[model samples]
Structures are given as C-alpha cells and as structure tokens.
Target: MDSDVDESLDIIITNVVATFRTRCHLNLRTIALKGINVIYKPEVGKVLMKIRKPNISASIWSSGKIICTGAASENDAKVGARRLARYLQKLGFKVSFSDFKVVNVLAVCSMPFAIHLIDFTKNNRSIASYEPELHPAATYRIKHLKATIQVFSTGSITITGPNVQNVAAAVETIYPLLFECKKFLGK
Candidate 1:
C-alpha cells in the first residue's frame, strides 16, 4: 500500500469470480440434479449450484465448464470450485478441478476526498472515459495495473481486473491523480 492514499482508503473484497475446466462432458438436460443444492434453469440452459461453506454460486453448463462467483477471497474461490467439483463427482461424473483460474476480482473502496470526475476526465482523456448520458461512472482503464476503475461523483470507486494483487497498486496509482484533479478544480 502506498502511503499517499493509505490514510483514508478501505478496500473490501466483494466478489471473486473463478473458472475451472472439468475436462469432462456433462449432459445438463439429462443430468440428475436431485439431492444437491442446485436448480436447473431451463431458460438459462445451466444448472446453478450454491456452495454454502465458501458462500459462492457455481453455474454448471452442458460443456462441463463451471463458473464460481461470489467468493470473498481467492482461496475461497478455489475452495468453492473444489466443492462444486466434488459434488459433481459424487453425482457420477468424472470431474477434475484442473486449470482453475481467477477470471476477475471486484473490490470497492472510497477516496478520502471528493472527486471532480468531469474535470478529471477532461484533463486525463487518454486514460478516462466519462459520458454521463451513456454511463454514470467515469471509467479509467489503467494499463499498468490492468484494472478498470469506475469512479463516481461521490468519490466511491469500483475496481475490477484479473489481478487482485493489484488492488493496492491501483489505489496508489489513482488516488494521487484524483487528488491532483480535485486540487486543480479547487475542491
């Protein structure tokens, strides 16, 4: 964590999405989802299973691809994936939890001071896109951190990207820039 933005910054892990390849073909239409905490939604063409321990929902498709979401941490995501895989195996499917990957991690935090999003976007057009009519959140695509920062007028930000390790890096990178923008706007 950088000292500049460490004072008033609070990062909360909202969700961690993970993907794991089971390397097995599943027949969603014919598979018996009985005795498991799963609901087959025909409209969505997927079986959604909820894992209580890690607190995540696993969406199983006919392709044997599983998407685990709502895990609070990376480890929880992995555990959630494993839990889903084990449950499927018990249901008579040859499953493997190999190639597990974290798709994206979402975190929310607030800035110490107010942000002047309009002015910030104008001065940093190359890094930001702010079209209120199109989208209320001003998005900043920081390449180095490989994160998309959605900044709002209320100074609260949503950071989404592949690497959760970059959360601190993101705070360090954006907070100063936001502060400078606020100062420039005499806020």
Candidate 2:
C-alpha cells in the first residue's frame, strides 16, 4: 500500500513538470516571432491622416500652396494635414520639404472653409498674425501662406495659392484612393 501511494505521487509531479516545460517553450517561441516581425517590417516612414468622412476636396493654387477644403471640424483639418503629408512623401518629396514649406494651415468652419494665405518668406513674416481681428486664434505661416483654422456649420472649403496648389492636387488624387483603405482598415 505504501509503494502504491509513492508511485502515484511521482506520476503527478512528472506531469506538472512536463506541463511547465511546454508552457515555457511556447513563451519563448512567441517572443522570437515578435522580434522577427519587427526586423522584417518595411521602412515606410510617412505621415498619416485619419478622417471620419471623405467630404473634403483639395486643389493646388498657382502660388505653390496646397489647399484642402471641406473639413467640418478641427479634427478634419488635422486629418487633411496628415493626408497631405503622406501624399507628399509618396511623390519623392522630402518630408522636411513638407514640414518647412507648410508653415501654416488655417481652418474656418463657416459657409465655406475660409483659409487665409500668408507667405512664410523672411520679408513677409509679418503677414502671419495672431491678431484677434485678422484671425480670432493664433495663425502660423507655412511657406508662402498664413493659415487660420476654424470650424463652421458649413462643410465646404477651398484651398488656393501656388505652393498650396501642388500639394492640394496631390491630396485630391490620393483621398479617393484612400477611401477604401479606411474601410478596409476599419478605421
């Protein structure tokens, strides 16, 4: 009877040790897979913009400004910038160019999105103003445009100027293509 009891105890301990060893192997495998994924991932360094609706339109003006119109909220305007950044990156334009040239982005949510243009040239730096009358909120200068962003009841916006034009055109082309991407990603 004592021998029978000892045999049962030994079996139980062996089973427990086997189970722990299996679990430890699985944990190590998981960690290895994660490290491999990080190493193999592509280096696609581009800015991303997310939007709730695809209601915006973009155009590039002759003054080299890229304009995005139809952002209904401040969030929408931010999305516009993000989208523009990605578009510029894909076109082989340096990310720094987008950062340096796009000095300001203004969003106004009125009947039409009223986007003010201010040149970021050294001599025209004064055009970018944070005045209450010119713009209720602070404004920043991007390249050759001064931007003020506001959310209005209306959902239409027009972006104009030469510098803004190229960027706007690129955005206009990319937004539609990205429409399905948003749905597929469930974003």
Candidate 3:
C-alpha cells in the first residue's frame, strides 16, 4: 500500500485563480471581436476568453485586470496569463504580465475511507459548519488555518482558501482529525 501522503491522500489542484497586473485598461468589445473563442457580455462588462494550451478561461476586465481560472497548477496558470498578455499585446494593447498573484487555490483529496460528517461536525462544532440545507455537503471552516474544507460522506475533501502557504499545514492538521472521524470498514 502506498503511504498516506502518496495513496490515502492525493492533493489534486482542481482550479487555480490567478491575477496579473496588465496596467492597461482594456475594451472588452474590441478584444472580444479580435479574440478567438471570445464572448463579450457588455452587460457584465467582462470578456470571456478561452485558450487551448492551458485550457483556461480568462475574464478580461476593462480595468486592466485579468482573472485566469481552470488551471490545475501554478505554472499552468502563469502560462495561461502570459498567453493572454501576449494576445492582448498582439491586438495593439499595452500589456504586461507583471504582479502575478494567485488569488485562490482550490484542491481536492480523498481519504482511504469514508468520513462521518455528522460526527465530525459535532466533535469540531467550533470550527465546522454543517449546512446540508444550503450545500450538498458539509462545509468545515478551519479559520485558524485559513482553509474551508467541504467534506462529503465519500471521504472526498474540497479545500479552498486564499492563502496557498497554509495548504500543507491545513492538510496536516485535518488528516489527523479525519482519521478520527473515519467511517469504519467503508460504512
């Protein structure tokens, strides 16, 4: 059997939202008309641009800001961002792929066994919130670690937060608690 870190849990980045300082105000309509696979929603004032290499969706705003999503890695996100900058530059826009920042990191992992969400939430009431009415799964907010993990009965965990720096710490902190809440014999 593989180790816990390697088998029981695998941190798979699902989506990475990255932002860059283009420093050039954009016209969504113009870019959309010039861009490929671009959708301009003037009502929303954002142009949705899709690229194939990194397979990301870039929301270009008129305020010189771009939000790139659907990337599974930081490098992929940056690559997609730079590609957008180059595309804009090609359209005669002053673009700079500077000040790149990862605004949000969303990842998922699965435990070897199922988790008793009710019991886990009850035990960690101070740090967890079970709102099945609002959400299909239980949302656990570990504020101290700057992470909000959505736990499902299948032992699948969706971890979301603004600080990627705390990811390792949050995973370490939660794994032990998850073990305690593990449903026995695949119950």
Candidate 4:
C-alpha cells in the first residue's frame, strides 16, 4: 500500500491501563469514607475510585498497589495515576508514588474494506482463530509484539498491546493480510 493509505489508517487509542505502588500501606475504610467518588468493598478488601479530569478509574488495594484504567493515552494514564496517589496523600496516608508504569493500551482502527473472516483466519491459522460460537470477532496474536488484535467482519479491529508503538506496528503488519481477504461489495 502507498504511504497515503497507511497515513489515512488511523489508530485511535480508547483506553490505557497503568499501575503504581505507594511506599506505605493504605487504609481502605478511611479512603472509602474520606475519598470522593469511591466505592469500598469490604469483602474484597479494595476500593474503587474515579476521577474526572483524565477520566480514569482506579482499583486500590490495602497493600499499596493501585491499578488505573480508562485513560485515553499513556501520558493521561500517568497523570491519572499521580492524581490517585495525591488523593491518597490527601486522605492522611504517607503515600509515595513509585514504580508507575503503563501496563496495557487498547486501540481501534478501521479498514477501508470489509474482511472475509473465515478466509482470513484459515490463511493465518497459526496466529489467528475464529470461533463464532464463542465470540463475534476473530482473535489474532502477534507473539513478537505481545499484542492481541480482535478483527471483525465489518472491518473494525480492536488492538491491545504493552505500548502504543507495538499496537501501531501490529496494525501495519496485519493490513496487508486483511487486504488479501477483502470482501468485494455487490459481488
């Protein structure tokens, strides 16, 4: 494909999952009471919190580990994680933000044409699997990039990877194969 086609294919990041640790333990009960927009589950021993600025949701464990999700970008994920730690600090916890890292990124991209799902999966059986009974989309795995792509018959693909670069690479790598099985409309 030409560079124009490649450039036109845009990868839209939908969610970013990040994780961080506080140096000290967190009191779930205190956070559930003192924190805003929090849901405390005593049975699970964890707290769920939401922040609006970066549009993130956090899962807080008493062990000082926090997992933040729903951010649209890596920077947003980091910012959201920091905000979570700050919230803990405001709650009277001697919190130290450490080991902050973006664990996973979810993105979507649409192809120019629809795909023949069965044909595509059969051609790439080693890396692709399609079980309509189990799920609508076919799952394709790229071992080297550690990325998983869910390809739909309607030309929409959902990709998840460790980072943005890998996710973009996975799309580029699969575009040619998808093109080969493109369904010709009105045929």
Superposing all C-alpha atoms, what RMSD in Å does each candidate have to the true structure?
A: 2.9, 29.0, 2.5, 1.5
C-alpha lDDT of residue 93 in model 4? 96
Model 2, 1-187: lDDT tens per residue?
Answer: 2342222111000000000011111122222243221222123321112223434444332122344445543345445645544544454434332332232233212221222222111223453343545544333333433322221112222232223333344334322322222211222
Error of 1 at 63 (Å): 2.1
Q: Can you rank all candidates by TM-score, best first?
A: 4, 3, 1, 2
What TM-score does model 2 achieve against the real structure? 0.24
lDDT of 3 at 110: 80
Error of 3 at 23 (Å): 0.8
- Strongest candidate by TM-score: 4
**Residues 46-140, candidate 1, lDDT per residue (tens digit)?**
88888899999988888888899999999999988998888778877899778999989999988766678888899789989999999888999
For model 4 the local lDDT of residue 111 reads 94
Assess candidate 1 and give its lDDT.
0.83
Query: What are the clashing pairs of model 1?
Result: none
Compared with the true structure, all predictions reach lDDT values of 0.83, 0.30, 0.83, 0.94
TM for every model, in the order presented, reads 0.88, 0.24, 0.89, 0.95
On residues 1-187, what C-alpha lDDT tens digit does candidate 4 reach at each position?
Answer: 4652554788999999999999998999999989999999999889999999999999999999999999999999999899889878988999999999889999999998899999999999999999999999999999999999999999999999999999999999999999889898899
Misplaced by over 4 Å in model 4 are: 1-7
